[model samples]
Target: MGTAILSGIISSQGSGSGTQEIDLLPTRFIACVRRPESEDAIRSKLPREAPDSTVSVYVKDNCAAAREADVILLACQPHLYKPLLLESGICTALKGKPIISVLAGVTSNEITHQLCQTAKTESKGVYDTDAFSVIRAMPNIASAVQASSTVLEIHPRPQLKGVIATAHAIFSCVGTVFTTKPGNFAACTTLNGSTPAFFAMVIDGLVDGAVALGLSHTEATQMAAATMRGTADLIMSGKSTLDLRYEVACPGGATIQGLQVLEEARTRAVWMRAMAAATSGQSSLKEGLKMSRGGF
Candidate 1:
């Protein structure tokens, strides 16, 4: 999912700017590593607008890619982060480069510590862990459409300023970016990372409601989605939900009547509970990762 979204952004940018876009980044080659059999499938899914030269796919050969790229994005499954960081030659290749992990259930500290351990083991006395950085980001599947609400977490290491700026630039191309502190990272994940799925559930409910009112499924779904998009746009444009509600309610109107039903059902409280559970689940996930990594 991350690969497809990133490829879409890179590819679309490539087409829009052509060779001129090469100036946007210091390095132009993007290595997308995957399992041997998955290489072809992943490549086939790349956007047609993507130029062949911008991204190269490698099969089971991540070290080579890391060595060639200045900045690396680790979008692999969360469970694979430690092993991959400790892979022979991978730490050496990744030494001094910025690594951005989109892997859930894994913390930046975990990834950074593993990398530091690998570097110390490989280079012995010459290792400088401060030279490298690890950043954790949570971007939803909406990134595929360049409209994700992404949240990023990073330590206040002075050395990582450039890396953070680079990350901001890359993600800004895809969607809005929010920098989150460590304490709030989990909460941000529940809101920014997981809320899209929650919104989808609401959309489904709205669509079902319309269908029950005699609208065809196709028309109902479209209208629900459009309404959602427009409502979000209006909210984004500085219109408060309260103001919008009053605007549509018109005192004793159907909108207000329907809102009363929603209020009676405690829909807002239900969503609040859902997000609270999800945020707690993220803490559990972090604990599980710590246990798996022997309390790293």
Candidate 2:
């Protein structure tokens, strides 16, 4: 995700000024990794062949490197995040800096408390202000190629303003950015994080249908993919998806015949059920965690 964000920021130079101007300059990126092996792997992946921009990579344990950063990203998995940040002493180092978290199922208030405890332990003094500002964001895999649909929630410190511009510039390079309430992050995760999988399944089903009609697997897949892409483009170009579907369903035509088959099978209801099941499972996990915590 960090690599994706970096790529988007660097590529935004060609995307014109309005939102792109806020992304970090290529030279400003300071990537830090916790493991030595991961550092070597990342360095190997750098575009040494023909590069327009460069990134400075640092290999160190988290907190130590975090001290020098004005904006720190916490990108580890949720279960490991609190313990790792607390143990690394990064929170103590964040004095008045911003800490952006991409960990799923972890709330800003929880992060604030953990950081406050860490800071208190390190300083042994009562601090009157929040030591760090946190922003929780949910960005999908498309970010790797600068085509993500990112959802962000700002939980700014009392003294901070104008941070949204910075975030917008950074995320806009990859795709669209939508401001959402912190409580909605989990729903955003289900909607955005799980969408690609849902789309892929639809594509696969289309390909299967094509293959059943005697097309080769490769041919079917290509045809299905192109059809799906074109449909998406049409929807994005101002036509509602339902409107497009209705347009294709000519009265008693081949398209309508196929639609009848799908309707009889309750295809739409099946997909709705699938999404509800996935969302319910995730919500249940959240509730279980809260119970374990004796209340979140």
Candidate 3:
């Protein structure tokens, strides 16, 4: 997800017509990984405005990255959060900084709790200062192509307005950005991440069916993908799903016959079940906390 956002930001900084879009290009980007060998992978994603911007990749040195960054992104695996803050000086360096975390199922409060655990203050039970200004986001791999459907958790943080706008600008470069109440975050996360993969699966099946019906695989794939994009555009433009479906399903039409086949098999219900299963195990905060104790 982090890599996709980097690629998207890089791609968004330029236009096909050769004009540079400077506003989308940040002055620097820092990416941290677990190994020095991983540095090249990040280097491969350098921004289009490289000379105008600098990218520094770190190996197992997130503390250094945190110290230098005005905005911090926590892209580590969910379970690694505990250890991430365990790095000496990390929690202190991050105090009151704007943080954007893409870890699924981890909340801003959970992250703040972890940081407080590490940076126990000399004063009574508090940090003697404000907690990290954190933003929770759920974005997908499609961000690489600038078509990601990203969600940002919205909570009352009157002082974090500037940070919120920064978060929005960064994400909007990757795709459409939607802000929803934090209470709806988990449901939105379920819809944000896996839907793209599910959409791809639908396109894949259509391509195979097209192949079986005599179209070349490559050509069928292109047509199916284009149709999917067009359909999404129509829906986004306020066309109701039922209206679009019925509009294309004329009386005695092939489209309606195909729709009947899907209806008989309960395809829509199956899709709903798949989505439900995605987060079914994450039914409680206890479960999420347990999972948080286990990743990278």
Candidate 4:
């Protein structure tokens, strides 16, 4: 996720200053990993051969790294978070730090309670200081290329203004960012996060249709992709999708003829039904607050 965000930032901002600009920035990053091999793999992908930024990559356990960090990011699998934070000494280290958990289905309230319990057991103060913040974010695969549409829900904190700004700046480098309520976070996931898969399926269908009509697989795919790209550009050029469809359906033209067949088959309805099924399943999981250890 971090690498994805970095790539987005680099793509949008153009690689120039190396790490000088990052170091001069107010925010500092410390990545905590469980294994040395993981750290080495992460290091091998740095923007520059050896960038000079305050972003330290620690190969120690979570507990050790959580001690000195002000804002801790939890990127482990959802199922592992509860047990890891409880069993690892890391919970004790996060005495008054803000936590940004990326685990889906795990609520901010749950995270707050778990950390608070750990703090109490360790004789530390309650995890309710002005600096003690928690936020939940949903970022899709595009984050790797810095072209993701990231959604964030931050728990209210007095000292979080700067942090929020920093987060926005960082995420904006990758793509777009939207602030939303935690309750709606899952909806955003279904809309923007899952839409890529939906689009891919649509493209696949189009390509298959072209191949069935005697076009080579590669040629069909390229043509379908370019057509979709052009269509998207047209829609983005200030026209409603429906309006654009009508514009393309020139009076009694081939486009209109094909559209009529699609309409007769209730193609639009079929698409809607598919989306409804996906949205319903997502809504059920979110309403139940069930945490699963799986990728989105």
Name the candidate that leads on TM-score.
3
lDDT to native, each model = 0.73, 0.67, 0.77, 0.65
Tens digit per residue, CA lDDT, model 2, 176-206: 7888877777778767666778888988888
For candidate 3, the per-residue lDDT at 31 reads 87
Going through the candidates in the order shown, the clash numbers are 0, 0, 1, 4
User: Candidate 2 or 4, higher lDDT?
Assistant: 2
Off by over 4 Å in 2: 11-18, 23-26, 44-53, 127-129, 154-160, 280-296
Sorted by TM-score, highest first, which candidate order results? 3, 1, 2, 4
lDDT of 1 by residue, 1-296 (tens): 55655654665475453223234454365555655766666667667766677667777788988998888888765655767887889887887888777766677877877887887788774456675688878777776667878888866889877777767766766677889887788788788877888998998998888889899999998988898999999999999999999999997688889999999999999999998888777645534344332111
Shift of residue 144 alpha carbon in model 2, Å: 1.7
Error of 1 at 169 (Å): 1.0
lDDT of 3: 0.77
Estimate the TM-score for candidate 3: 0.88
Better of 1 and 4 by TM-score: 1
TM-score for all models, in order of appearance: 0.88, 0.82, 0.88, 0.75
Per-residue lDDT tens digits of candidate 3, residues 194-256? 677789899999999999999999999999999999999999999999999989999999999
Which candidate number has the best lDDT? 3
Candidate 1 wrongly placed segments (more than 4 Å): 14-34, 124-128, 284-296
User: Distance (Å) between predicted and true CA of 234, model 3?
Assistant: 0.5
